[model samples]
Target: MKSRRRWRWRWEHRGFALGLALYTLLLLLLVSYMLDYGARRGRALGDWAWEGQPPPAPPPGEAAAPPAPRHEAKRNESEDSDEAGPGSRAGGKRHIYLHATWRTGSSFLGELFNQHPDVFYLYEPMWHMWQALYPGDALSLQGALRDMVRSLFRCDFSVLRLYAAPPGPRDPLAPFLPGGGGGGGVNLSTASIFGWRTNKVICSAPLCPAAPRARSDVGLVDGAACERSCPPRALRDLEAECRKYPVMVIKDVRLLELGALLPLLRDPELDLRVVQLFRDPRAVHNSRLKAKQALLRESIQVLRSRHRAAEPRGLPRRHPLLPPGAAAALAGVHPRQQHRAEFFLGGALEVICQAWLRDLLFSRRAPAWLRARYTQLRYEDLVLEPRAQLRRLLRFADLPSPPALEDFVLNMTRGAAYSSERPFLISARDAREAIHAWRERLSREQVREVEAACWEPMRLLAYPLSGQEDGDRQEGGTVPLQMFV
Candidate 1:
């Protein structure tokens, strides 16, 4: 009887041991499967995140255009190769940044610098950043944009390679490229830049044999002629050309605030100066609406930044007011979705006004040294008094207003026709007409909306509110220029 009891106990112990071993094996298998699945997910996420280069889970209301082919190369081939650190400035160069927003007459403002024989100007060089990282919140991309501009100021063209991807089919510059492929260390040329055809440095001697060197007397270089004559010279060659100029002017509408640029301003080596441009909000809104389709992607991105900043951490990813198909509109595949486009456009304008107000407040309280380095210009003032304003603008930059430059300015502002269709194109236009075009173009309600949204900034900037008499307006008095003499 004792032997039988002991055997029973041993059998029970063996059964419990077998069960424990099976359970442990099953747990191990589950863990292995989970790890493999997680790794696959991480890689998939990496494609959109660019290995965490951009932020995650893009704002819900937006969709990025299909990302351009990724360029994976060694560290030497990247913009990281730039010698200057983020705070380090370039010496022996007077760097000027035209700080403005879209449709604020900034293109024309930039062209003035581009025409100067002594200035090497880059029109929206950071545009490549916005394009390559489409739908990335403007706030998140600010660092990368700032870095690119820093490198460009130092004449480091390798920064361009970081965004060197093949142009999309809808890209206007696509047809200009003779050949195209993008990969690690792809050989980029002048054709790869956004306004390359109009770039005087690329169109002139040593880079393109057919075109004469840029001079005030030369006026605007024939962009078409330059496109036909200039083949794709290496970007390194362009950088060599960039080094020859004393003044480097970069005009970009992407950088939204004056405060964000304090680091660059403080860089002793750069000797950096800023020219901030402002326009009447109503006029800006009108211009934006007219070019709604072309501006769709940018509008969505701006709105995304505004939404992200305003929303609480646990709130819904999308704003309640944002319409469905916002993503589709961004992708350019849903042209029929006009409502989505308009909502984004209006939201973007509101955000722009708020940003401008923030800039205005910051500029008012800046240190004396910073104030000395910054200047504010009004689009209306520029157009209303071209000769005087042009002289003032040049004086601020320490550039002389040559006879040829004066003529160029006059011709541009006094031209006969303004093409609404190709609004982005840089050409001559009736300045007075362009400034007041909003009065007739925008509906009364639209004007009211802008005035309400931008009332604080408008009041401070001396813009007249809707329904107010000219005599009653703040600007009725002689408004002093916030300029550094």
Candidate 2:
């Protein structure tokens, strides 16, 4: 009996030990799972911070939606303004922003809208703010830029006077003079508005006697004649003309971040829609290289803004060499100094790519209102299929796609010859040559640098990496949509 009791006790202890070992194994797995989950959650939160919003949680048991179809991604026109704020009303004028950086063919894109008779288009209105506040970091100037954009959309041209006026003891005509009241500020007028010479509205009828307005008018404006005929008009008169149009569009390169424009996006009265244009970074880099001298100041501002953002608040440091008044002196920089400008401009491309990545990621995770109000466009696609792309653009802006507009787009892309004489000139050009020109113009090393710096956005934008055939033509690649709407 004593022997049987000892064996029974030993068996009982062995059973308890076995159960504890199993429990410990299970506990380890639970802890490991919790750690992994925490890591994934942290990464997701970091990404959401880019856009300032977290994506909505998925429903239980729902598989994640597949990547958006090409057409769905491009066709983001949301007809229901139910989500649009209280200021939204039926039949309100549509406001559009042609969001692009400098020299991405934005001038040509804006020209398309400018030629539309029913549209009132302003080109680079923020240019006044940028020029007025030169040496101000781009990040610091965003508030003023946003305000200017908001006011312009409302047809309150008076806001321009804040930046447009000569900085010294104010003279109304100071903006018209070569130097702002002898302070050497920008020369401003209805005639001096960026791209005003090519503006159909400014060049036609009520604004100028150069050409009579016609419903079928789709020809490029004769900029020389327009400059000769159109005199400076009062701000109030410009506003009056602005009011007559059913649609208002502004093209700007100064607004760097999509998040910066959220307030405008939320404004119901303005009913803003954005057509954000992107170009291959390699091409943009090539173009910037060609126009480096002209773009130096802007490039400096872009770089300084990025550097300033990373500093602790109130650090107050500025580039020792780049003083507020030093911009005027860049024109005389010695040949050796040109390398410094090139280096600075190269940094600017990185800033631009960073901005592109931020905008793209934000748009992808954006809420319904944002998704509704935004559209993404590629410069390559625009030139490759002008007619189809133009129709889609007009559709997004609620404009009619007329035959004259079609003809205008076709003729603009097919020119007599490729010319770099007027790099910034808005005229017909050989589209194919323009698209492939960078291949020959950029050295292999230069191409590699641009690709290396911009690889993230290049991938997201579907641009093929160097030496790869365009994915659009490759197996398993998407076919370009014949129509977006």
lDDT of 2 by residue, 1-485 (tens): 99999999999999999999899999999999999988764432222232434333346554355433322221133434323322333245778999899778998899898888778899887876777788987777876787788778877766666765544223322344233332212444565465566677677766665464442378876555555566766655566666656688998898777666766676656778999998878888888888888789889999986655532122222222333432342334332333777788888888888778777766776676567678988777787789988998998887788788888998888887655566766789877777777888987667766766676677678776654545344321223422213
lDDT of 1: 0.69
Which residue pairs in model 1 clash with each other?
Answer: none
TM-score of 2: 0.71
Number of the predicted model whose lDDT against the real structure is largest: 1
The segments of candidate 1 whose C-alpha lies over 4 angstroms from its true place after superposition are: 1-91, 167-185, 212-216, 310-338, 472-481
**Cα lDDT listed for each candidate:** 0.69, 0.69
What ranges in model 2 sit over 4 Å off?
1-91, 167-189, 210-216, 310-338, 470-485
Which candidate's TM-score is highest? 1
TM-score of 1: 0.72
